[model samples]
Target: MKGLPAGLPSLREVLSRHGLDARKSLGQHFLLDPVLLGRIVAQAGDLDGRHVVEVGPGPGGLTRALLATSAETVTAIEIDSRAVLAIEELRQAVNGAEGDRLRLIEDDAMRLDLASLVPEPRQIVANLPYNVGTPLLIGWLRQAASWERLTLMFQMEVAERIAAAPGADAYGRLAVLAQWTCRADLLMRIPPGAFLPPPKVFSAVVGLIPHPVQPPPDLFRSMERLTAAAFGQRRKMLRGSLKSVGGEALLDRAGIDPQRRAETLSVEEFDRLAQLL
Candidate 1:
């Protein structure tokens, strides 16, 4: 692992020099603690040969940590122009030591084709922007094979939804889809104070490693539709909730109880229902 280049400036100094403040419109909350940043990177497991992709790298706090790893490359995608300047400075600071290992892209993460951007053996690690986090994750899950692992930070509630079990209130479409495609876990809980200009809610990091065996494209689509109908009206019995998908007849076909609610069904049960579709 390459040490951070000598005389690298601190995150605060980077932000200050760039006159960058966390922007609520962009859902930006800069994580300024080096220890926490390192811990987040650790959650992604060994990065020795992985190409790390970071989104919304405000002032490149986590970017700095990633560069210190043995990761083959760290590609940061930032949409905010001002913050991009801050990260540019970081890129320059480490250019000598990191060489081609650090690449900065000033673009919106949601609009880019990630698979094409970062080749195989890729891992995504980021303190995701709050507003677009779930949407971005859902997109990635649809193409889970493209990534080796995903270690991301989100609001504590969102993290709970990702790792929640069948009987939990937090379990729903996200939990079903996420668990179906990958092994999801809430890795660490971070306090609001950990961020510069703290957010109102606590944040937690979630780690996801895709299962070796994944559903076929058709089955995955069926699963998405099934979860949408079932959790769309989560309080209703599966018979009523899934009426548009297939209703009680479909449940009878799959040997599931029609009276059960969406939250009560296991990932396997949902898969069973999806297969019938």
Candidate 2:
């Protein structure tokens, strides 16, 4: 592990050989710090024999860490052609046997049917692309049952929103959904200096373990609509924001004050309002 398997070069060497540089357009910032990568993997708990799916594995940094975990399978989805080739070199470099557990998919993560693409009993671990992180999160939440856990990296602000509680400055739709459906927590803060083309902002790793008792599917769908309406005008009163959906009368039935803003509503109130939709 000190160096790569026999003939395989180190990750840094591989990237250098391929002339790969992090792309700003893709929101790419390669996490080259091995220590940090290992820490992200450790936060997901035991991966032994578990299936793992990683998205946006730029140059196979975190993907390599995941493969080392002895997981039954490690699938990496990448949209960058250069990264796809780079990861291929990694599979051959690390271990031929690792290729048995490692898989590389050349496609955009946003376009994949994530649930069916990978084997079940899977934990999604990735340093997600900054561009599509939030939308991808919402997609996963809609089908939270498919994943056993999600250990993801995001801009610190986005991570804060995921683990934030009601009434907090960062709390909103993402908070309500993440909190209600998953036991969300912030594991650690990662500094910009950790990456190759270091991003301007800091990043954080967040762990989300789906709650055993999920909300009603109908209620979940309702919450989506309610949250959309409410947070679409987050600064406005619930009465004003809810108007597009129903208005103060609906809020009255949910037993929530019309005067309250979306940021003030707890997960329970949001779910209750969702029921009205």
Candidate 3:
């Protein structure tokens, strides 16, 4: 078959050429499927004139697709030096027009302050490293208003949790936090075979558009603490589990039944409880 381009190699060729083997330690599972990558980029709605931030651009697979989109600029953050070298060709392929728009930052995404780095109207499009995905996502959600949207790929289980409804079994701390500040949905599922050194579990792409209005600032923090305590002992009733915060009185004040389990509560209920606390 044909290759990607003369300098810009296909995912397989890049992996073979650079000894860029997937490192389990880095949560590196390189996605090689162009179709799936294109779908993920498209789900970001309209990237035109928007600044796109991508994390862990492993071998520039998703990066290439992002560059091909309508985004005004694509700033890719990658910690792996090897991947940095691979993306150079991607930068070249774009040439002056779109290519000049690509900025490859060799740094740990966890340490970067996204809001300060990229100008307003930013959207993050990434196939995140599994090890840091949840923590990174939580950090971003804490500052949800900074970005226009987020198009991310995560393990299917994680994606389900992000898009889970109040009463569903998948609903928990993630669902509460994600939904409280953003409108989230599972866009599509990508099979294990789509990746080089495919992960054992299936993965899915999720889209999150930040809510225009966020919950009260203090209430957001309080809700996080409350949920952490309540779900820490998830099997117990809220009355028992929440005693560390304000006991049954808090639940009573929120008009929530103390007998209800944490998993059964809605995001609004959590917000009310936080307000009461």
Candidate 4:
């Protein structure tokens, strides 16, 4: 509310003026509710003195909410040139202290190294584009040490996968990688109606706090490979599914049952197998 200039055009007006409609290919779903935007930002906890990174800021609805906070800086990355042009007004409207608080980058988030964007105490808060959300999250999980927290919104199914337990249907590579490197929690569930061009499915917000102590880089890589093989054929036993990796020999080495299915193994069990790799 206090972040943008007085009488700045509403999100819908801005989109209409810029000829911007939600792009399905880009997984864009614009959220315009200021109160909802503020609530999403709240999931990130205290932003004071922390640098925040936002990805796929379609109309800057969430970006505006982030600017309203006490964050040290908010760097927004947008792949679409049209989106960049649309939010330019919001960036220009902020003068004085808030002026320098917003930085707009026109680029792809997947290729960019987020850690290099700012120093420690950095966090990523975004309504990630649905198409690339998982890969973006995986990249962030690998470099978990670089972040203080990760507050992200994804399709409800994907969010469930990230926070799912060992036996849950949603549990898989996403959960294994996320939980292995960080503490993940399902923070909020949002309905389809929240967005300007609502998606057919619901969305949920997940908060991840990276563990202070993490496995070495090689171990993380091994875990990735292991999970891939195991879940590649979720119905098969570990011995059959993981055959390409190491098969029965690997299972014997890790002291895990050869008959166990991929979904049945806990995160710790997965780590144990990864260690043997």
Candidate 5:
């Protein structure tokens, strides 16, 4: 199969040369298969002239694949010092037309001010660390206008939640927020053995197309609080669960049944509850 060009070291070679292993505390699971890496980039769609932001690029396996594409610039954020060192060669190898196309930052992606690094018309594509994936996604959702698409990988359960329907088992806080602000799709499921130190659960990639129809600022806050309350006590009926947030009166005002459980409420109903709150 075609893979990363001949100039840069293979991902396995980079790990070996640097004497590094995936760090569990950092949620590191290095993807060693370049073929899989190519496939993952392919899922990001045509990258020609588009800027991409990648998080947790361990050993640059997926990073190499992304750079191989036509993407104009790729800002890769990584937390591991050893892994950052490992990417130095890859960075130097990117010369000529790919000049400065790869910006490797050693920092926590969760804390990074995304606007500072990400240029307009960006897409987030990553083999995201299991620990901070959801928070990172939520942060991106808040700045969704700056991004074109979010083709992100997450634990299968988390991916399920992001793309889940109101009645599905995985649907909850993340789902409501994701579906409300973006059109989400579950692209594919990946087996555990694809990575160096394979994760226990399978992983999945989800693509989110951002929409401009988000709730107004205060209403968005209300939606978050309302989802937290409803799903916080999911088994309880809306009237009992939402007591602190106006409970039955809020339910009456929204014209939603007080007896309906949180899990059963559609995104529109959730929005109504948020608006009423």
Candidate 6:
């Protein structure tokens, strides 16, 4: 054990020693600030005895913080081979109890069936690569019942969309789906400069606690179809945009005004439309 402080070296030093550099193609931006990394892990709350799944553990800055937490085990999915090797060094640095608790899986997070990878009482804590964050989130939301919590980082815009409510500019399909199934909150914002190769956009951590129970079985699919059409032509009214699915008639059936725009509709309103359709 490395004692109370953990005594880990700077992420820049680790990257330089390992000959690791961020790959733009992979959307890799290593988060090097220890204070920020610690904050991300703290957002997950009481990880002791809990299993955590992390995506894109580039250079393992966040991974090291997760290890310092009380988490029982950590399964980090890294797509880049270089990152896998770098994370191995992090595993060694943590040492004892914590070191033995880490597991690094070198694979594309998008392709992995996360619901099956870890058992129940699991939490997903990660500073995800920007390129695949949304798709990966939708995949996990499809299996929302299996996991306990999701403490994730995303571009500030995306985080806002996830936490957006009815009538907000950020509200749309993501808001509907995320709100329909989970309680989401914006935890904290991180400046771009905090990263190794600072991304152009600011990022924020969002926490999503899955609903203990799900909505109607077909609610997600319906909302998906509805939003795809509604937001596909955001400037158009719902009556015009949703014509393929029943248009004004569908809204009438669902008790929603056909003149409303997609961004103005609440999750409950979307759910009602989905149920009617």
Candidate whose TM-score is highest? 1
Full ranking by TM-score:
1, 4, 5, 2, 3, 6
Write down the TM-score of every candidate.
0.97, 0.94, 0.94, 0.96, 0.95, 0.93
Question: Cα RMSD (Å) per model?
Answer: 1.1, 2.1, 2.9, 1.5, 2.2, 2.0
Residue pairs clashing, model 1: none
lDDT, candidates in the order shown: 0.91, 0.85, 0.86, 0.91, 0.85, 0.84
Q: Please, what are the lDDT tens digits per residue for candidate 5 over residues 63-178?
A: 88898888888888988888888776777677443568888888898888776786777888998999888889888777666678889999999999999998889889999988
What's the true lDDT of residue 125 in model 1? 96
Pairwise lDDT winner, candidates 1 and 6? 1
Indicate which candidate wins on lDDT: 4
Clashes counted in candidate 4 amount to 0
Q: Among all windows of ten consecutive residues in candidate 5, which has the lowest summed lDDT?
A: 1-10
Which lDDT tens digits does candidate 3 get at residues 1-277?
1113345667889887777898888899988878878887888987878888999998988888887777778888989888888887677666544445888889998999987778878999999998899989988998898989999999999999999987788889999999989999999998898888888999999999999987666777887899899888999999999999998989888888999999999888888888787
247: Cα error in model 1, Å: 0.8
What lDDT tens digits, residue by residue, belong to model 1 across residues 1-277?
Answer: 4758878788888888888888899999998888888988889999988898999999888998898888988899999999889888888877776677788999999999887887779999999999999999998998898899999999999999999998998999999999999999999999998888989999999999999988888888999899999999988999999999889999999999899999999999898889899
Clash count of each predicted structure: 0, 0, 0, 0, 0, 0
Higher-ranked by lDDT: 1 or 5: 1
Q: Candidate 4 has what TM-score? A: 0.96
Q: After the best TM-score superposition of candidate 2, give how far the Cα of residue 47 lies from its true spot, in angstroms.
A: 0.5
